[model samples]
Target: MPSITINGRPAEFEEGQSILEVALAQEQEIPHYCWHPGLSVVANCRICLAEIWAPNPRNEGKLEPMPKLMPTCQTMAQDGQVVYTDSPKAVANQRSVMELLLINHPVDCPVCDQAGECYLQDYAYRYGRASSRFEEEKIKQPKKDIGEHVLLYGDRCIMCTRCVRFTREVTGTEELMVQGRGATEEIDVFPGKGLDNELSGNVVDLCPVGALLDKDFLFAQRVWFMTKTPSIDGITASGDNISVEHNNGTVFRLKPRPNASINKWWISDEIRYGWKFIHDESRHVMPMLRSRDEWPSPKAAEAWTASMEAATKGLKSDGRLAMMVSPMLSCEDAWHLGQMALSIDPQAVIGVGPVPFNGEDKSFPGGYTVRAEKAPNARGVRRVLSALGIDVLDAVGMEKALSSNTSIDRVILTGNYPSEWVTPSFADAVGQERFLLLIDTLPNSLTSRADVFLPGATWMEKAGTFENVDGILQSFEQAIEPVDYCKSEAQIAMDLQSALSGQKPTVFNAAATRQAMASQAALDRFVSDVTLPKVPQTVESDMSIIEL
Candidate 1:
């Protein structure tokens, strides 16, 4: 490894690594803009200028500091490289650059959506002069709606060309471009088409200034006011990394949380804007048990116990029990459900629910992909069932087991899909012989026919891990409490098990459950306290790694 001296601190670097990259890896301060790991480096913005030292040609063998500052972003680190980010010359240059960037920037911090988390504000306070030198009229540029979800304020741009490079190099759409040069330079989309790619919202996150904004999250909430919880996107089996940003139990937005092994620095638009369903008011909120002559009470605990009694009353000691666990459930929930079923009948037929699929996997030029499989934890459900010594069945096999064998009398179904998963034909296939129990987050046609309907919790309202498409077990935290009367799938499973054993039902604790199951082969590597990789904030670095 090559070594570089930055601001009097020695740091090792890989071959061909730049000075800016090495400095950031060591958490050293070096102010920069126009450099993002996910995009190409234009080096147009001169904010990262730093003094460089090298052997002088004029002197025989003495080292001399370069008079002209070098852009640290474009300067490769050599074995004996010496870079000074805090030298008198470098400090003066940084201050001057900050002043220049703010010359035309409007003082609209009160109205800016990115005010609290804006890097420009942080750098200006640290490296800029107290007073302005410009007395002339400032340039004013009109804001433009460049895309369906992207809005652009031309004046706030520093011509870093990151957004432009993303469309060209990453998405390969080439929708955005630099329309002008120098003082009049601005970001614009091609005419007759907008920046509406499947991965367009990432530009707002890429912007260091308040130039680009997400239309959906334009004025939702301040960054400081919202609590961020690490989560996995439920849109696809890929399980792209994300952070659920909410305030007072209301989710305001979903943003990418970098995971070097999964999603890296970007996520698809589905992951960015697919959280609206979590807040829908029409979702089922209360557990209910449908008796032959009357309706059960709405009380969660009482209804939970009654539902379990009704569901198990029709079950026989023979292998007559069937369970369909949805792939949307976390591994812990699925495992608990399997355990509850096996406790009732050792040879119970357990299977995964219907998995939704759209078109084939769509691959982008930059190596990002949106998988065709829509479920988040199919691998997880299978792994859980296999660990419990239960032979799993698919939708077809489950139907066959019910239809071919007239002895199968009890059925339990669990799901939290974004769309209609239970069709009329699916209900027709089950026939009228078996009593049905349903656990779901939304109200579908299947709810009306179920003997026991248990309101289930969404992924946002629970904390657990999912084995993604790649079989990597990634954990997510609860963003908010379960909606009115709803209990988590794990909790519901625990309650059901308690009712069978004539024990009082208790709420499930995810951390404790994970610890208990730590010895299982399926969850051998499960970690409950997983967090997103750190987003370096010090400055000066551009290293892109897209693990799509």
Candidate 2:
């Protein structure tokens, strides 16, 4: 490995790595706006300029200084290279760049959406001077609604060209371009096209300043007040890592977490905006049990004893129970539900629920993908069932069994799909004759027909693993508590198990359940193969406050 000294700190680097990349790896501060690891390096942001010194071959290996400062982003690291980013010359250049960038920038920090997380705000505080030198009027540009999900504020843009490069090099749509010259330059859409690509929302994330903003989250909440939870994409099988940012139990936005193997630095607009269903008013918030006369109670309960008792009224070892596990469930949820069904009747029919698909998989030039399969855990459900020594049936097979299997008189169905997933044929298959126990997150025809219905939690409200289409197991943490009166499917399954066995109910723990699954010979991989998202650490400052 080649070694370099950056600002008195020595670090090792691999060949072809740039000074900015190495500095970032070492956790050193190098103020930058235009450089992103996933995008091409244009080095237009002069804030990362650093003085360089290299060993001279002709002068008996003596250190030789370069004539001028270099852009750390574009300069590759060399062996025995010395870089100074905090020297007087470098600091002067940084102050100058910050001063220039702020000349036309509006003083909208109090009203800007990116106030706390804006790189411009951070650099301005660190590198800017006390007052402005310019006496002329600041240029003011109007905000433009560029696309369905993105808004462009021309005056705030420092012309880093990140958005322009993303459209041309990543999506290959070429919808965004730089218009006009020098100080008056601005980003604009093509004549007949808008920034309406499937990945257009990413421009908002790529913007280092408030120039680009998400239309859906424009004035929703301040960044500093929200808590970000590491989570995986639940709407698709792409398994893109993401951060669920929320405040007061309300999710404000979903931003991509960098995963080199999965979604690198960008997530599709569908995944970014697909979390609205989690807080929709139509979600089920109470457990209900139909009376003998077929009327359901309107109130919810902390202990759903009546619903559990109704679900297990006639369940016996007669092998008359069939379970349909939805693809929207986590692997731990599916496993617990499956074990409970088998405990009631050893020969119970366990099958995976309906998996939704739309069109074909769409691939982008930047290596990001949009999957056709809308469900997140179909593969995980199938894997758990297979490990339990059960031959799982597909969605069609389960529907057919429900229609033809006259012997099955009790059914346990779990549905956590984001939208309405019930069909007339499927409803008719599980006819009114049999006992239907449904655990679901949303209202549909089945909720009305179920003999006992329990409100279930969404993926965001639960902690568990999901297997993607590629058979990769990824785990996510619970972002927020379950919506009022709603419980996780895993907890519902455990409660039913306790009710049937006349034992005390145990609290469901995702990690402990996974360890129990790993105890089985076929599922031992669950302990080792599941990929957990990295938890960010909070660094406390050493500075103490004094009362004035």
- How high is the CA lDDT of each candidate model? 0.81, 0.89
Candidate 1, pairs of clashing residues:
none
Candidate 1 Cα RMSD after full superposition onto the native fold (Å): 5.6
Error of 2 at 114 (Å): 0.4
- Find the number of clashing residue pairs for candidate 2: 0
Q: Least accurate stretch of 10 residues (summed lDDT) in model 1?
A: 528-537
- TM-score (all chains, Cα) for each model: 0.91, 0.97
Local error of candidate 2 at residue 501 (angstroms): 0.2
Off by over 4 Å in 2: 292-299, 314-319, 539-548
List where candidate 1 sits over 4 angstroms from the true fold.
55-61, 291-319, 504-507, 521-523, 527-548
lDDT of 1 at 204: 91
- lDDT of residue 6 for candidate 2: 99
Kindly list the per-residue Cα lDDT of model 2 for residues 1-548, writing each as its tens digit.
78999999998999899999999999998999999898999999899999999999999989999899999999999989899999999999999999999999996998899898899888888888878999899988889889999999888998999999999888999999999988888899888788989999999999999999999998999997889999999989888999999888889999999998888899999999988888888776777766532223444452376677777674643648999999999999988998998788878888998899999999999998889999999999998988888889988898899999999999989998888888899999999988888899878998878888888999889899999888889999999999887899999989889988999999999999999999988888789999998878875644597899
